[model samples]
Target: MKDLYHPAEPSLFTGRESANRAYLHENIRTVDLRSESTPPTGKVPALFGYACDEGVRRNLGRPGAAEGPRAFRRGLGKLPWLQEAPDGLADAGDIRLDTDRLESAQQAFSEGIAQLLRSGYFPIGIGGGHDIAFAHYKGVRTYLPTGRKLGIVNFDAHFDLRSPGDAPHSGSPFFQIARTCEQEGFGFHYACIGVRRDANPQVLWDRAKELSVLTVAREELLGSALQASLKKLKTFLKRVDAVYLTIDLDGFSSAYAPGVSAASPMGYSPWEMMPLLDAVLGCGKLVSMDLAELNPAFDTDGQTAALAGSLVHRVLHYPGLF
Candidate 1:
């Protein structure tokens, strides 16, 4: 059976040049417990994916999230080449998820990430929803057992800190991570950038303040220069050992990114937002990244996906201090 979601085509971005897959496959490796085989070996970074579309809505008998991984792969495949490198890169393929088992799905996703980290590979997750953040954090925590403090810089219109309940939805990831870290005696710092003033509740704001989270409101974001915001964010990240970046496409204005699960009228333009990411890349310790909420059904001309793909390229291509 041919896998519809095959590893990325080496020639897609490499053009007529000698493909990197042969070299990468020999050097990069994956331990397949199912087949009882040793992992592959390569220098190219492995792109591990989790296409989760399961959540409360799906659990309630709505559409399943099986399409997320494919949609994101489509976007990624369409990305333009930015820089040249000798290393080969390939998608490690999606982590299979059970829609009916949320906790189990989270555990599976987390373990996949832990495995990738252990192999010294960078993992770029494509979301089924923002709730995947919890799994990403879990992976980071599991891999970094040295007690290194980690910080999160989330770019979203919603705060995503809703109280824990029987069901975990996309709107409750940050809260779940925060609460989990608190219970486990870990230092987790959170900074919410590009937040919509009206989207968050008073209680959420009070909690953020109490936790000393650096909340940058949309109004403040629009008012101040991007350089200023970058400066402020850099200072915050400096206090932490490593950083995980989660960018929710809804943080971009509807005109800029109309494909998001929740589009907002007042948000940053693509040009306005890219610099912030550039600033984050400058920080040098960007451990992992997840770009979420891109609903292609609402997109026109594939612009949103293209924009997202470009950002992913930038994240991978950008030079760093590390």
Candidate 2:
């Protein structure tokens, strides 16, 4: 495997080191997407994992998320399979962000996503914030011909359907996406999984119902295992041409993933969530994926990053098991 670290930083974490070499090496790939060079196109479909840490901690009006891509890369460096996989995987790197020009940054990110799709590559976006989902969805739209609907599988604790106002933050992605679909006359079928009743706002719930979106609450999902929920998801996927998967870390309980901005005390366990991912991959038309809301500041140990890294590895390696 190639060395993916900068000469200036040789240590992993905030100087903390672990012996999980597979976690650091096997399932990781890196790229600097900010470069002007175009991505190469080839036969076997390519998978580009993007780490965009632009708006990561913007709710606090601070910077540091720019390091998100590198941090995740370092964690992945310790994983071995990522390095050994024969699959066509590349790191598209992080989008450069100008703190003062957020809209421009978003446009750039959206364009990067579009380029990947046009080149016929599957994109797995990592971090920054849930807000990036809007741009990701927009990129997918470019690939769809007229009259095609896009299916979305959002696994998160919150609905993320907050009203989109002048400055749409991370919490307002779904609202923007729904609005876009309505205005453009593009059909969208969205299924929200792992929602906590207490976290969803009334307006969002009303909108979800009005749109005929299928929402599987946490209580209902916890009552059954991941396989059962996935069985239900397959029915939803059949209605659309392509699928986009978004995973907010908060969907997992605090015990399993405490490194998210909105940690939930009761959420899915790793054992439970893996099967859902497996089922989504089985759908065979996964266009793009986003894993968001990972706040390293809140992590006790490196457990959250390790778990996320493992989940990513599984999603990339295991295509389908229907």
Candidate 3:
């Protein structure tokens, strides 16, 4: 695992945006270049980034999410924390792909995460692409007890359940997961919020139904307003013992998050999205989580990365019931 990734730089943590204690660069732990330093004392959540975008290229999409980790770090570095504990933050650095070996990279990522969970740290991943979900799921699965079911709550516009071609891509994470769940005899309970009708085609829709996936279409996500969506999500969480929450920044409108690969003009706002996030954190079943698809190239004023970073801050600080 040593050469599989680069260690984080302490320089990335220095910024004078404010005098407040919200600056992540000052507070976060950086993995040393030589080897791992001792794990921070206490039950703190560990954070890491996936800095590869080969999944986007494999899917025939834009390139640049490889820079997501750096952008997210810059955005996150400026925030001020309110009543947060200092020892709770650790940055494990980014997972690097071994020269077109995305599968190996993913497995390394999974093992890294599994290690974090085994050591009593809540693991949160910032992904280069949505494909990280499959790896993230694998890490979560490694820690769960036998016979336990895992549920995923994804905030995205598409199902990401397309069947794989020669290998896995960003579009086929859930499909791969669903198939594996069947083989492993574990129930795949997914509740997706903010699915866009125009973004996904009919076959994907039918496939989603076939898998018995619970979807909250973009319109329905805001049908009775955000509180209703939060309530529905809360109800969905009751069906599983543990959870892995994924946020694809593309789920938000381009106006709010313009840096994503496939920006949507018609999507939820930060105002409309946070309540549901609050509810997800409130559910208390969260075992792992990921924030994906923050393409800084298309971003305006670092809004998308900053938003992802803000959400990352929230999730990391959440004192979960687990």
The residue-level lDDT of candidate 2 at 180 comes to 87
Write the residue-wise lDDT of candidate 1 on 211-317 in tens digits: 78888777656545656787788888888888888888778888888776677778877676666667777887777777776666667676667767777666656
| lDDT, residue 213, candidate 2 | 78
RMSD of every prediction: 4.6, 5.4, 2.3
Q: What lDDT score is found at residue 261 in candidate 3?
A: 77
lDDT of each: 0.67, 0.65, 0.80
lDDT, candidate 3, 1-322, per-residue tens: 5667777755665566556555666677655424545665666766778887788788876778878888888777767655654464777788877467778778878877887877677777887889889999998898899777788999999899988879788888999999989999899899888899999999999999999998888887564665667767888888888889999989999988999877889988876767777878888788888888889988899989878877877775666532
- After superposition of all CA atoms, the RMSD between model 1 and the true structure is 4.6
User: For residues 72-156, could you state the per-residue lDDT of candidate 2 as single tens digits?
Assistant: 6556555544443434456665554545445555566677677767665677776657776887788778766777778999988
Query: lDDT score, residue 35, model 3?
Result: 53
The candidate that achieves the highest TM-score relative to the unseen native structure: 3
Runs with alpha carbons beyond 4 Å of true place in candidate 2: 1-66, 82-88, 98-100, 224-228, 320-322
Ranked candidates (lDDT, high to low): 3, 1, 2
* TM-scores for all predictions: 0.83, 0.81, 0.92
> What does the lDDT come to for candidate 1?
0.67
